[model samples]
Target: MPIFNQSIRRKIVGIALGLIVLMLVTSILSMVMSSQVGILLDELTNRYIPAYGHLARANIRSLERSVALRRMVMMKMQAPSEEEAYAARLREFEEADRKIDDEAEAARTLINAIIDDSRTPSDNAGLARIETRIETALTELRQAMNEDHAKLLKQVDDKQMTEVRGTLEHLDTLRDQFNQRIDTIRADMLKQVFASTRTVIGRQHQAIVISAIVTVLAAIVGFAFALLVSSGITRPVRLLLAGTREVEAGRFDKTITVSTQDEIGELAAAFNRMTEQLRHNERIRETFGRYIDPKVVQGLIDRPEVAIDGERRVMTIMFCDMSGFTSMSEGMTPRGLVRVMNHYFTVMSGPIRGNRGIIDKYIGDAIMSYWGPPFIEEDEQALLAGIAATEMVDQVPALQKQLPDLLGIRAMPAPCDLRIGIATGEVLTGSIGSELMMSFTVMGDAVNLASRLEAVNKVYGTRILISQATADAIGARLELREIDHLAVAGQSAPQPIFEVMARAGALTGAQDSLRAHYAEALAAYRARRFDEARAAFNAALEAVPGDGPSRTMLGRIAQFEAKPPEEGWDGAWRLEQK
Candidate 1:
C-alpha cells in the first residue's frame, strides 16, 4: 500500500520500533556511566552535602529541649505548697529531663554517624563545633537546675524562688546561643547542598540533550536507508499525489515529472495526462462566464458528484421580478434585450451578494435567490434578504435611465419597477436533477409561495410582499402592513401576508395611529369581543384611509359576529398557500 494510505496500526508500529531502539541504546549508556562515574558522584553528594546540615539541626533541637527541661525542673522545685502538688510537679520535671537526655543521646549518635560518613576534615570541623556548643550549654543548664533544686528542697521562700528563676534565665540564654550557632552552620550547609544539587541537575539535563541528539541522528539515518530501499516504488507515487492536489486547486499550468523508469513513474505520467483534460474543461468554464454568473457556474463545476434528490431544511427564499419588463422588452431587439437584461441583473446582483444571499438561478428578467444551506445564521437570513429586496426596489428608478432604448415609449409612461417576494420556511436546497447534469437549486412549497407572491405584487401594486412567518422572524426591524388574510389557491386556510414599506425610519402619525387601532382590534378579536374589535378597526380606517390590514380585520370581525365560532375557539388564522 502507498505510504499516504498506510493504516494507523502500521504507523504506530513504526513509531514504537523507533522509540524502543532509542530506549535500548540510552539504557546501555546509562548503565556504563553509573558503574564508572555515577556511583562516586552519588557518594560525594549524599555524604558531604546533607551530613553536616542534618547533624547541626539535630544538635540545635536537642540543646533546646534540654534547656526547656532544666527550666521545668527549677520551676517544679519551688512551685508546690501542697505535698501532692510537689510530688506531681517533681515527676513531670523528671520525665522532661529524661526526654531531654534521650534527645541529646540521639544527637550524639547522629553526629558520630556524620563523622563516619565524611572523608575530609572540613566537613567534620563545622559540625563538631556545633555539637561542642550544644553539649556545654546542656551541662551548664543541668548543673544550674541541680543546684536550684537542692536549695528549694530546704524550704519554699521568695529568696529561693528568685535564685531558681535567675538560674533558669541563664540556662535559656545559653540554649539560645547554642541554637544560633547551629542555625548558622545549617544555613551554610544548605547553601552547599543547593549548589551541588543544581550542578547535578545541570549535568543530567546536558546528558539528556546529548542523548536526544544521538537518537534523532540515528532515526534520520534509518529513515534515509528505508527511503533508499523503497524509492523505486514510493517517490513517483508521492509526486503523483501532490500533482493531483495542485490540479484539484486549478493550478494545471505546472506539470508533474518523475525521472524514474518504473510502474509508479508511468502512473505519475498518466495522472498528469488526466489533469490536462481538466485544464481544457477549466478553459471552457472561463468562456462560459460571459453567459451566466461565474459564481453559479463554478458552484456547479465544483460539486459534480452531489446527489440530486435530497432532504429539505428551513430557509429563506426571495424572488425579484422586473415590474415593467413586459412592455419594455417589446421594443428591444435580441441584442438590445440582452444588454438591458445584463444591466438589470448587474444592479440586482450587487445588493443580493452584499447581503450574502446566493443567486440560485436567473429566469429571463427575474431572479430566484435564497439564504442558508451554503450557510445559515439564526433569524438573520430573512432580515438580510428583506433589506436587500427593499434596496433593489429602491434602485429601480436609477437603473431605468440606463435602459432608455430598451424601454422605448413605455419608459415615459410608466418607469421600470421591481417587485420582490420573500418567504422563510422549509425548502430542499441542493444539487437537483440527473447525475449527468445537476444544478444547485431549492424546491418546496415555500419557493413556490415566494414566486406566487412576486406575481401577486402586480395585482396589489405593492413592491415587496412577505409572508407572516418572515415578518414574525424579522421582529421589530421594519413596519409591515398586513395586506390580506386570504387563502391562496391550493391552501386550505387563510394566511396573513404583509408588505414591508420602510425600515428604521420614523413612522408617520397616520401609520402610528393605524398600528395602535389595529393592535387594539386584534386584541379584542382574540378576546371574542367582535363588536369592540369592529369599533377599533373602524378607528384604524379613519386614521389611515384604505388601510389594507385594518380592512381585513374589520371583515373578519363582521364574519365572526354573523356566525359565532364553536366553543373553545382560539383566535388563530391559518394559511394555505404556496
Candidate 2:
C-alpha cells in the first residue's frame, strides 16, 4: 500500500504483469478443449448431418414420385390430343424416380464415411445399423414398387381407367412402406447426430466451466490487485469523479480532496480551483437569472451571436396586470407594498411558467410573457397562453384572500383582480438594447397589440381578451366569446377580438346558450341588420342579463339607430384612442 503511492507507472506495470499471466493460462486451456470439440463438430457436420439431410430428401422425393404418377394418370384420362401434358408428366415421374435412388445412395455413402472415420469416436454399431436399413429399404422399394409403378404407367397409357385407379392405390401402399422405413432410418441418424452433438456440448461445457472458474479467479485477482496497487491513485480519482459529477449536476460547492502528493493529487487540486470558478460563475447566473428568464440568460451565454441577430417568428404574447393594484398598494407601507407585490407576482407567475410561457419582464403590476419555441410548441403558443390566463384568473380568489393575510390585515383596502390580454402574430425576438445594456425581448405588432388588448379589457369590462390570431390558434380548446372586431389605436388592420370565458367544458348551461345567441347577434350586427341584431342581443341578454358583449352590442346598436353608420362601415369598431 505504501509503495502504491510511489509512481503511477510502477502500479500500472504490476497490474499488467498479473493480467498477462492469467490470460496466458486461460488461453492454453481454452485451445486444448476447443480442439477436442472441433473434432466432434467436424464429424457431425461432415458426415452425420449430410446423411440425415439425404434421408429426408429421399422421403420427399418418394411423395413427389407418387404425385407425378397420379398426374400422369389424370392426363391420360384427358382427351387423346393431350399428348404434350402427358409427356411432361412422364418426365417429372422419371425425375422423381431417379432422385429417390440418388438420395438413398447419397445417404448410404455418408453413413459409410462415418463408419470408416476414426478421427472422432462414434457408435459404430449405430452407424452400421443405419447403413443396413438404407440398403434394405431401397432394395424393397425398388423390387415391389418398381413393378407397381410400371403397371400404373402402362394402364394409364392404355386408357384403362379402372385398372389405373386400382394399380395407383396398390403403388401408394408400397410407397408408404418405403417412406416409413426411410423415416425409421432418419430417426436413427438423428439420434446419432444428437449423441455426437451432446459429446461436443459436453466438451464445450467443460471448457466454459473451467474457463469461467479461471476468469472469475482472474477477475478477483485483477480487481483486488488493482485496488491494492492503485489505492492511492484510484481513491483520489474516485473523489475527483464524484466532484465532477457534482459539478455536472450544477452543484459547485463540492471540492475533491487532495489526499496525496502525487500527480492525481495535483489534478484534484486543479479540479477544486475549477469548481470554485464555476461556483462563482453560477452565482452570477443566479443573480441575473432572477431578473431575466433562465432560457434568455442561457441563450445569451451559450449563443450570444445568434441571440443578438434577431429572427422573425410567430409568438403568443401576454400582458397581465393586477386590476386596482395601484389603489390597493397606496394605503400600505413600502415594505407591505413590496410584500404584496412579491406575493402577487409569485401567485401570478406560476400559471405562466407552469404552462411553459416565459416571463419577459415584470413592469410594475404587469407581467409580460410569451409562449413559443423553443420554450413551447409553436402552434400551441396561443392555446398555452389561453390556459395560463384561465389558470391565473382562477388564482384570483386565493390572491384576494391572501393579500390581506400577507399584509397582516383583515381585508385589503381595495379589491384586486387579474386582467390578461394575449395576441398571436409574427414578432422579432432576441436581445434588444444599446450595446451598453441589452434585454432579451420581442418587439413587433403582436407585442403592441397584446399591450393594447390589456388596456382594451378595461373598456369591455372583461377579464381576458385575445386577438383574432390568438383566438384562431386557441381554436375551441378554450371557451371564448366574440367580443368585437376592432383595429386598435396603432394598427389599421381590423382584427376580431374575443374574451376567454374558461376551459372548454367549464361553461354552464346558461353560458352555453348565451354564447350561441351572442354569435347570432354578432353576425346580425356585422350585417347591419340593426333591428335583428338588437332582438338577438336581447335574446342573448335573457340567458345572462349581465353579459358584457351583449350589452356592449346593444349600446352600439342604439348609436347606429340614431345615426346610420358611415357607408361601408365594415361593421368593425376602430379604436380612436389607446
Q: List the global CA lDDT of all models.
A: 0.68, 0.88
lDDT by residue for model 1 over 1-578, one digit each (tens)?
A: 35423333454465567667766787776565444335435744555444554545455455655544554454545534445654655566566566555555555455555556643223466556645754665576567657755554443434465665665566566556655655664565565455556655665666677667766776786676456535645666677778877877868865777554445656667776777777887787778654444565665556544333455778889999987787767766788788788888999988988887788789988999888644548578888888898889778778877677554534444467888989889987566767587666788888978887887776556789998889998878877776665455556656777888777565798888887887788778878988888898899889989876667667777788788878976675544434
TM-score against native, each model? 0.46, 0.61
Q: Candidate 1: where is the Cα deviation over 4 Å?
A: 1-252, 255-275, 284-306, 374-379, 405-413, 429-440, 477-479, 503-578
Task: Work out how many backbone clashes candidate 1 has.
Answer: 1
**lDDT of model 1 at residue 198?**
63
Model 2 CA RMSD to the hidden true structure, in angstroms:
28.2
Colliding pairs, model 2: none
Clashing pairs in 1: 491-576
Mind giving the per-residue lDDT tens digits that candidate 2 earns over 217-296? 88898888877767778788899889989988989999777677667877888999999898899888899878888877
The best candidate by TM-score is 2
**Residue 181 in candidate 1, Cα distance off native in Å:** 89
